[model samples]
Target chain A: MIQISVDEQACNGCGLCVKDCPMNVFEMGSGVSIPRRPENCMGCLSCHEICPAQALEHQGVVPSRRMYISSRVCSMLNRVI
Target chain B: MTKSFIEESQQNFQHDLMFRVEDVPLKCNPPAAELEQTLHGLMQMNGYIIRSLEEIAGRGANAVTFRAGKKFGHEVAKYFQKKDNVEEALRELSYILYGQYSFEPWKPADKDHYIVEENGSTFIYLVFHDCIVRQTLRRIGQEQSGPLCQTLCGYVVGAIEEITGRRAKLEIVHTGPNACLKKVILK
Candidate 1:
């Protein structure tokens, strides 16, 4: 199960989430984004990440995490920390 | 003012972005330090090859990714074929994959992996808190990337074929930014 919430106050009705959602979980309704097919939400954060207004919130286990740091970056961090 | 605004937004974003999964079963293999080291080397080599192919071929990266994954799976099967049954071999392979992913400095600390058997079928579940492929797609503003998932499917299917001598069906049961469930059914 997944939960998607859009902050009405924060949402600018940009429709980025509606367009970016791979599952088509959202729709533009009355100048706001509605989670029309919330059940189909895959928990992919594309919508959340793409939202310029930071209005969409998703709650579910994302299948994989992206944390790529090069060895050069690691060494730099080591020096800094 | 700009910094404060950014900080406030960050705070709000962090407060709202809550993810929870209940009592996920952890099926982990004991560390095989020597074997892990070897697999790590192989993966690094494969990574280099895949990247080189992608560089040369551009859009054909998916094919290279799938072929490399299949070859890697076959190699894993060949290595463990003599010592263990199909299920055990897969479990071991799962461990190696998990280890390889976790060993990366960029991987999320909370990511998890599991292998379970149900109704005479085996399931390998990998939970990625943040998938690189997803991130890449998002970065490029692409709505979907079937090839990325296809690469994984090819690997699992190839491995199953090597072990059982039968092709397995790969199904994506769930997809989320934080979690995706792929099931490999031996057929």
Candidate 2:
């Protein structure tokens, strides 16, 4: 239920994703990161954090909670904008 | 006033600690926003305390938090009816331990085969998407997987121990900005 994409142009073929993914979801394919075992991906987005080029993308995954955003920052923004 | 990102993140939390005190005398209880803000602060403070304890005590912090977490875990266990079946209890426990929006269970593609077995140990993988500790660390620009994480591990083991009367452990598989993977080992 998760779809992963790699931006070929954006990808530097660092293989960091392949190395970082606990599920072994990515594999280096001809100097490009490929979702070789996408089904294994648990949508932890560990690849996203490791990829320096920001080439990986995932769809159909639940978004993380952002309600923890600082109240001070929000209160300041409420007054400014 | 325009809605802030805080409100957008949690629609019910429409205001960031804004209070309406234009009432007769004063209210016995605090406003909903105040209660919510207090909870947010409490969670953040938990993180801060862990980090501070770590700085002062190093590995000693883990022991302190672990004991506290286990105690809290037992306290939480009192609320739930103990199930005779281990798997059934775990299924129920997941509802409380892994919240709907925060920590979520990561099931394999094989829906029927939900629980994974490796090296003769049964495991349930949980993917934490919205962890308060993670948020707190990010707020202070501190790295993740510190001693605070051990508290959660202890909590899980403690809860399972109380509920099922079986010793268990929580293993941190991996961590990331968006999500983290934790494995609950059934012993």
Candidate 3:
């Protein structure tokens, strides 16, 4: 089981994580990002791949925890991805 | 709007942590009781979010507004988060600023100017009219609203003050092709 944590400080309220999660693990409030379906996260790492702010992290997982690029970098890395 | 959003966040996300960075003498600064009146007055002017434990930096200060986590651009690059990404963003941002890279806005008129100051420690993006318009690639997440802008500005200003140990100012010049200005004086 992966424990997902969303860093409020780093989140710029972009809402991309809310959309990228296939499990519907994230929610959007006004402009901020919130974790709604954390349990639903299948460890697919889709949200991890799409997160632009590097705000979301999986704590419980062992070795090689997954991370994602921020939205700002997404614009730059879109071509490579 | 920034102020309102902060309030809403505090009320809604009771579990989440909120931080405010302010530039005031570490100890010489007035106590919260004294600053309350000033903060209250500033609140009336729109877009003010003051949280407890506003880390006060002392003396002359000016620097970059560094933000990490999910919402800011750092998540994308993870440079600051990972040191290497910071170097890369600086390289790209620098190249673009010096007219070396071909990175230009899709709309010629909607040019978003990026400013790198304090030896690349601070990156200031003067996103003008174009930022006000939402992009097709991002529909639900585009930062087009006024409140978000104000909040971003306030947060940046506060963070800059904290990072540099002084008050920071951001000037939003109305240089849009179709722009109108209304001036108000604080008496």
Candidate 4:
């Protein structure tokens, strides 16, 4: 199961996550975003990308495959990061 | 024969560049390093080409890619035996579609599909995992559900139509970074 948390202090009342999430996983309450249906989250991370406030945090989601990145770049990135 | 100075220089240059001292070995599957580099370059080039096509030709580019994907879909369906029903047909597809790109039915809460009471319509949802198209778009930071995504839409529609011998359409319900949810409607 995936767990998502919204930082109320960091939330700027932007509803981009609510509007962009394909699964209808988030809803607005008191001008803040709420994870109305966390079970439906498919872990596409669209909400995470669209959020300007970066108030959403999710855990326990499978990371997507990383084969698309070039091997050289990945090797270089691995060294530092 | 005496050692040729030119040949020695060529070998040294090739070694310094980390290239094969001799000509690249010929093989159907060249090498992982070369293949990954080619795929990465191709995806970036395709990203640019697709964006340019859309910018210049608009929907024309989509029609072109959709048709190409449809042809590929038809070709893929030819390899499998036809099934009696849609479920069975899709089950056949799901059976073979795996590896680098995989498809799985979205059965949230164990509900296989959604049924509409008003007209008794049924909609089957499929989540595409490890999609290469998504990977390609993401590599260039392009938006999802764009024209490139249409190729997959056409492919699903084509494959389903051919396998089930019915007219089918695939709709994008949501485009996420990792996976995408699509609705398959057969007529």
Per DockQ, the best of the predicted structures is: 4
**Candidate 2 DockQ score?**
0.50
> How badly does each model clash, as a count of residue pairs?
23, 0, 26, 0
Estimate the overall C-alpha local distance difference test score of candidate 2. 0.77
Question: Alpha carbon lDDT of residue A4, candidate 3?
Answer: 84
**Model 3 chain A poorest 10 in a row by lDDT:** A61-70
Please give, for residues B1-187, the per-residue lDDT of candidate 2 as tens digits.
Answer: 8988887778874567645678465574777556766766776787677778999998888888878778878788767877756578776677657653256567656566657777866777888777766766766667777787777777777787778776778888888877889888877
Q: What is the interface RMSD of candidate 2, in Å?
A: 2.5
Go through the candidates in order and give each one's DockQ. 0.20, 0.50, 0.02, 0.63
What tens-digit string does per-residue lDDT give for candidate 1 at A1-81? 678899999999999887766557789998999998877665556677778999877777344643322345567999999
Candidate 1 chain B least-lDDT 10 residues: B101-110
Rank candidates, lDDT, best first: 4, 2, 1, 3
Across A1-81, the per-residue lDDT of candidate 3 in tens digits comes to 457887888888878777655346689876768776565443435466567888878755322111111344566798788
The local lDDT score (0 to 100) that residue B64 gets in candidate 1 is: 66
Worst 10 residues of 3 chain B by lDDT: B178-187
lDDT for position B52 in model 4: 95
Better of 3 and 4 by lDDT: 4
Candidate 2 has which clashing residue pairs, if any?
none
Estimated TM-score for each candidate: 0.51, 0.76, 0.23, 0.80
Q: Tens digit of lDDT per residue, candidate 4, span B41-137?
A: 8889988988998899887888887887788788888787777576787877675455545766674654535522224334677878778788889
